[model samples]
Target: MIVTPPSAEEVTGHAASMYDRDTQDDGFVFAHTQVMAINPEAHEAFESLVKAIVASIGIGVYEAATLGAARAIGSAHCLLAHGRKALRAGVLDDDGLRAFAHHDDSGFSESEQAVVRFAERLSADAASMTDADSQALRDVGFTDRQIVDITLAAAARNFFSRALLALDVPVDVVPGVSPKTAAALTARVR
Candidate 1:
């Protein structure tokens, strides 16, 4: 069955308001995330599941791979959110975050460095993935199934990030960051 598009006011009036208010509370605007304005219920459900997976796995591994992919793909949206989240996950700090912004390698462990590189290559050219790529993950002790999960995690964010970019979402979520990213995060606060 097809669900009709929500009324414009239903999204703009109520959803937009709360989203913006939350941004203000965070001192960061993320309303430009169009998912905020799409189907709220659906978005929440999808996020909940993703969070559940992260909570279960322990964030260090999952987020490193995800953010690595974000950087490879140059996704401003994912990079901003994931940068903060990674810090909060205790996977890295402000300095670490800055290093990631430039693909600097000093802040990460050798294993982490490998994972990040794998994420970058995979994100840039999943279609070109070969036995060497699989071998790299295996060398890191990731089973085939875990590698699949890592790929999914990276790809999922790609979908969301591209969607937000397509919608011309303004991000103002983190001010110390780039302007477009900040506006995309904060532009359409509720």
Candidate 2:
């Protein structure tokens, strides 16, 4: 069973305010934020980190990397969340976004394919990454800054996956997913 994190009402001070803002923004509090709310400072730091990362890479690339890593790790919650973000950013449609798990067969552009592969590789075994991997990204016209952003995006997704998985959070915790999208992810995970 999942360990229930403190609810918005259970928190006080900054955490409580953040929770209120999250509810206001989305009409429901996110489970990820709820988990982070246990330590308000950490939750704030996480939000700040996400902001810096998103600024470094455009939302499209960041969300793409996130989808790739989340898919590789089989985190259905992230897959749906980032998949939606990618769709909204016009990076891909739902079908195209879902195809990221096997991007080689998905008809994505060469650079997009490279980013997907990088995220998959990073999720699978980051320590095994070598100069050739970085070189491949450069070969695809990614600047060093963009490459770093991709790496950070993939790494951050893995960090979140590990934490959420360890906590036994249910995949349904993802908010605003359509039934079709949720079914697709559930089918994929199974």
Candidate maximizing TM-score: 2
Q: Tell me how many clashing residue pairs each candidate has.
A: 17, 0
Task: Encode model 1's per-residue lDDT on 124-145: one tens digit a residue.
Answer: 8889888898688779777766
What residue runs in model 2 are displaced by over 4 Å at the alpha carbon? 101-109, 173-176
Q: Summarize candidate 2's per-residue lDDT along 28-121 as a digit string, tens digits.
A: 7777667767778876776677788778667766776787788788887688777766766777776665555444426356677788888989
lDDT at 114 for candidate 2? 81
lDDT at 155, model 2: 89
Please report, in order, the local distance difference test score of every candidate based on alpha carbons: 0.65, 0.75
